[model samples]
Target chain A: MRIACPFCGPRGSEEYTYLGDATVRRPEGDAPSEAWFAYVYLRDNPAGRHRELWYHGAGCRSWLVVERDMRSHDILSVAPARDMALARGRAA
Target chain B: MLAEKYSIVSVVAQALRGQRGWKPVWREPEPRAEYDVVIVGGGGHGLATAWYLASQHGITSVAVLEKGYLGSGNVGRNTTIVRSNYLLPGNIPFYEHSLKLWEGLERDINYNAMVSQRGVLNLFHSDAQRDAYARRGNAMRLHGVDAELLDRDAVRRLYPFFDYDNARFPIQGGLLQPRGGTVRHDAVAWGYARAADRRGVDLIQNCEVTGIRVEGGRAVGVETGRGVIRARKIGLACAGNSSRVAAMAGLRLPIESHVLQAFVSEGIKPLVDGVVTFGAGHFYMSQSDKGGLVFGGDIDGYNSYAQRGNLPVVEDVCEGGMALMPGIGRLRLLRQWGGLMDMSMDGSPIIDRTPVEGLYLNAGWCYGGFKATPASGWCFAHLIARDAPHPVATAFRLDRFATGHLIDEKGAGAQPNLH
Candidate 1:
């Protein structure tokens, strides 16, 4: 499969690493047990289109926005997260 | 000696050559049918993908076809270590999200997938390794991940028995990642399967894929054991056999199979507290909560679906681990297992669209598949469900190999100590 990363450009699926389901958002502290479970392990497992997160570890080592068909690997678009595109890691 | 034989090499060798009871008989070809979505490989990634798709995106009709039981592939064979202290901007965040996901996986999936954060450390003896650790620690700090640089004294404090002043591969200090740990690998797949199954997804076990029925540049369905299950879309989570699986669609993923072995010592008193990796020793060891020593080493440099590897890497790993922790040298290894690591040329992962219209891929994870389970499912699910790449995984595309835009992480100065 072809993955179009933001910094590394479009590369083969072999060059990137699949992290996991990106939909589960870990709610900040103080959420209920159901909310925590939903954020932690709950998922859609959609049969059609799904929005997920990926990492292009073989290239720029950047997270990728992989828009693909769950029924098929037909990718529609690839980009960075809403706020993370501008976030660059710094040396501690 | 660095070049010697391991105890359980014979069994693994037989398993690889189709001698043992578990040779993979790929599903034969059959008529195609059309369904909404189909996920190949019943490993952790594929099952998690199904779970995410059905639960998050409201894509109800999904099928996960596994060549074997839930995680009989690399999922079951991996050395279930979990850490997010990556130096790369992309990997650090992606793995950090995965680490967070692991903390609550058991409760979330309603399965006891023992995710433990017992701390992990990468010992640095050389100036170059130290520099790399500093850079990596900085990246972790930047991403709000818990990481720190420990001096030799701190290292000695944490691990007193380690020979701090050894003449060979001296331990100067280490980069400590307190949040890193291990999990029950097989349980991860089972837990995800149970969760997905509970949410109304059909998991067809022992269903091998003979061919990807693609028509007019689109994936029509798959030929499986239960006959042709027409899938509107397909996700390839086949790791070790990724190349063969993709070839059914007439595509060759740029992946080279490498055999990776892991060993476990007879249950002894817990001699180690956390995962200890020798930066220069090409070895790493982690004491399971049950007091067994989980060990692994560098990837056996060869290409094939041969799940068994040569004995040299195993010996090297044990040598390195023993060199660092001399106190554990007397413990006998109970068993050792080998798995095929679907190693990509660039030493990363691929999660994107294929040339075929209806097929997506999430393979070529190399030796890091276990830790990236949740995140891989999330990204692959996003790519399949929304028809768009997540903002985070923008770099790993199939075209990168063709264009020479590889994310080579196995080269010199790589943040991963084992490589």
Candidate 2:
């Protein structure tokens, strides 16, 4: 599968390293252990649409949030993770 | 009554009678309104669980509900390699028990599963890898499981066709498990189903469990496509869809489903005598009785429920195969298929009671489920029948993830794909 990187155009999926579940946000330093456990281990792991983190290690070396269908491996959209985090009111 | 016992005399009698006396292997039965135990998923593990529950625990009032036909899941999709060569204390005993169960499976079930103990060898390419394998082999020996460390010349003497002289990643040695090999993957489900059926366990196919009926924090029954069937106890043996099914009961599992692909080449003369794993890469291969080279590599390294994988993994597996044995490059691949793996955070499986009362789970198998089929069933049956964790499976507690007692076998913490 070829993923369209915002900076490097389209590249083979091998160039990108996959880290799962981009939807998870890091909890505060003193957050409850339950929150930290969920952040570290739990996952929705939906069979349908999923937004995941992919690092463009072989390309622009930037982390991208790639929205794709887990059932079909079809890429729906791609954006820089920092931009998405900023837009979601989280610190970049 | 139980079906006719299979033996050499029975085979000859059947041949003389033109095989007309052979009955159906397992009976088809309608789901009853209630059962003592209800098991979700009719794959190898589910069927085996039913069999063990009936035969060992005397809990014959059991039902196994399957969404599809038997052996349609990872049981049939796996490459069929079985081994107990492990390192960790929590894993070695469990898998060793499974291996011993495999040794007596066909006789116990009265079915020819073709359980071949042809040995499994893990090749080492470097000094550090050799040292690691030596440590693993020593651990297996300490546990009374058969393990042998072979030198480079010893490996060369057994299999002379390897790319042993390659400048990069030259073959150093191997760790051999003589009792580890392959079984007929499909026959495992069939045999277990028939055994359980003979013991009065209901094998219900095409019965999809849509929802789990939870009454005041206890699972009472399940809402299936056919009808609501109540049970005193419920066991979830659903492998790939463990997280999804558990969600039906208002629970989330520490599992991520990833697609793992297996490939087979066109039937040729017997080449690979036994299972061989490439240490430098993730490829493992064995020759089936039909002469097809049954092999597989790593998972797709992504969260996916799709039963199909991308080309990158296929290419990577082929590259690993070529690097190990150059001769296989000439052979064309005949078939390739994928199965969803319920990869757990610690790369180990969980077979314990959930927080919800009367609800048990048997999931997080990752890539190791096929080999651990019998012991998983045995342990799960013990758990469901007695409401207690099997001694060997005590480490697979559901609360371990929350309690900081994770059995990180691969040392890859909290990453399902990495495991």
The best candidate by TM-score is 2
Give the lDDT of residue B36 in candidate 1: 85
Kindly provide the TM-score of model 1 when superposed on the true structure, using C-alpha atoms: 0.74
Best by DockQ: 2
CA lDDT of every candidate? 0.76, 0.94
Model 2 DockQ (Cα-based): 0.81
| B88-190: candidate 2 lDDT, tens digit per residue | 9999999999999999999999999999999999999999999999999999999999999999999998889999987787999899999999999999999
Q: In candidate 2, which residue pairs clash?
A: none
DockQ, each predicted model: 0.02, 0.81
lDDT of 2 at A21: 92
Model 1, residue B181: C-alpha shift (Å)? 0.8
Worst 10 residues of 2 chain A by lDDT: A83-92
Candidate 2: where is the Cα deviation over 4 Å?
A90-92
Q: Least accurate stretch of 10 residues (summed lDDT) in model 2 chain B?
A: B1-10
DockQ, model 1, C-alpha based = 0.02
